[model samples]
Target: MPVTPQPLGRRERNKQEKLDRITAAATELFAQYGVDDVTTQQIADKADIGTGTLFLYARNKGELLLLVQNAHYAEALERGRAEAETIPNVLGAVMAIVRPIVECNRVQVDNGRFYLREMVFGDPAEPHHGQALSIVARTEEAIAAALGRHGPIATGDAATTARIISAVMFVTMAASVNASLTTAAILQDIEAQVSLLARR
Candidate 1:
């Protein structure tokens, strides 16, 4: 008879199990009830863990929400960067970045909704806003680089134009999420928006 492989250590296995449970419960609850309506106790119950155990992983609801958003956003950004590399045209690059985010917003609508709530109501003095702003700045830089190479935009105004385009993209994304617009619709609208910006 083949010997059975030893199982994972209790502590390591239990910790992984708890994390999985917590994430699964959070995804389901936030999806169904909206993040604002879901409670830590509810999440804990859904995970079949005590509320206290839940706190061992997350300090509070806000932190848990931030964690969830960060995970999703990181994945989306990676995909955006990959798509950006493939597109040769500046407009194509910008659209690649925006399209992934819109898709993520649609797929993770609840988490997207929760992120919007935090952006509105969370401590305005918090550093998360600064971090998010930095991301926008980096995106603007990428657009500027892509556009500066071709006869895309005036060299002197490339940065400004990129920033303007970034602002338009974000506002459009927010509007799309608010209106529950599909990603395809968002991309279609973006083509018109970018065309107007190209003339600037």
Candidate 2:
């Protein structure tokens, strides 16, 4: 059996609550008003925290975007897993595990820009960067699990195959964003890649 982890201390839990409040407020504001138009003071006000206190969690609006986007990405990954379970084919399964996140980015394109920038180049020491990597890893695992259900090509060596598939998914998403392509086009490209990969 897996070991149960220890619980966070009271102080740590309180800190997490504060972070959650700020992220939730930021998500609402960013979604409703767009990231560029939303101010840090507005976020602080929505969170019911002092301006200075909000700064303690995130240095500025960009970092605040990271916090909010991380939460959004995590939720998307969970949704992807549940959705993936209903699909029967590897390509469709992979799409089920990735489409939610792609659509989330599409819905929040402005923040998606900043979020992708940070994901590629932000300081790995930062909390959000680390958290984002963990979320991506989990997503990769989900993709791998779906592939495992369909073919020996993936299940024969799950870890490396998963990473490769995840990389392909990320590349498809990045290309879609950079080229301003429709989601249908992006999924078509992904299907092509997975079809080729599945045959190998």
Candidate 3:
């Protein structure tokens, strides 16, 4: 039998509304001022919610960042995956998957670096942190899929190579030495490394 899902009750609707407001507020504030400069109280004020109420949505600012950036990262991964589908060359396909992510991370350099820190160090038990980690895993999966499509690379090799590529991308993006580099420059560096790695 076909079944229709029930609509959200008032309580659920209110919670969704509050969450939307919180996300919008945090996104704007984080973009304006890097995550380090923004406070939880400021976020609460921007959201027009009490500090205590904001805590219910996100335990801390790191989690709140995870909340905000996770969506953008997920979108970037999707775009990369779609672009990878159209490119047949292995390196080109991999770069297609990587370019959008690098662009997304570089959107606000400090925020991007801090989000990487939070993803690495934040409590995995936290829901938002888990979501960020999930996006990363999905990114690797997309890369592995791209590799698998191109040549005789075994599934295991593809997965391992994807992990290496992911590590290179993250390190290159987060590295202090590369901090001042423009997105094109960073992409060029990553492409050089990926080209070396993609050679089978």
Best by lDDT: 3
Each candidate's clash count: 0, 0, 0
For model 3, state the Cα shift of residue 47 in Å.
Answer: 0.6
Using lDDT as the measure, name the better of candidate 1 and candidate 2. Answer: 2
Off by over 4 Å in 2: 1-17, 154-156, 176-179
Estimate TM-scores for all models. 0.69, 0.80, 0.98
Residue-by-residue lDDT tens digits, candidate 2, 20-106: 899899999999988899999999999999999999898878788888888778999999899889988877888888788877776
lDDT of 1 by residue, 1-200 (tens): 99999989999899999988998888788778777789999999999999999988776676567545655665676677677777877678767766776676667565675565565566645555444445556777766766676454776688888888777766666664455776687678876888677655
- Ranked candidates (TM-score, high to low): 3, 2, 1
Cα error, residue 107 of model 3, in Å, equals 0.6
Best by TM-score: 3
**Judged by lDDT against the true structure, how good is candidate 2?**
0.81
Query: Which regions in candidate 3 have their CA more than 4 angstroms from the true location?
Result: none
Q: What is the C-alpha RMSD of each candidate to the true structure, in Å?
A: 6.3, 3.6, 0.7
TM-score of 1: 0.69
Query: In candidate 3, how many Å is residue 10 off?
Result: 0.8
Clashing pairs in 1: none
lDDT of 3 by residue, 1-200 (tens): 99999999999999999999999999999999999999999999999999999999999999999999999999999999999999989999999999999999999999999999999999999999999999889999999999999988999999999999999999999999999999999999999999998997
Sort by lDDT, top down from the best: 3, 2, 1
lDDT of each: 0.71, 0.81, 0.95
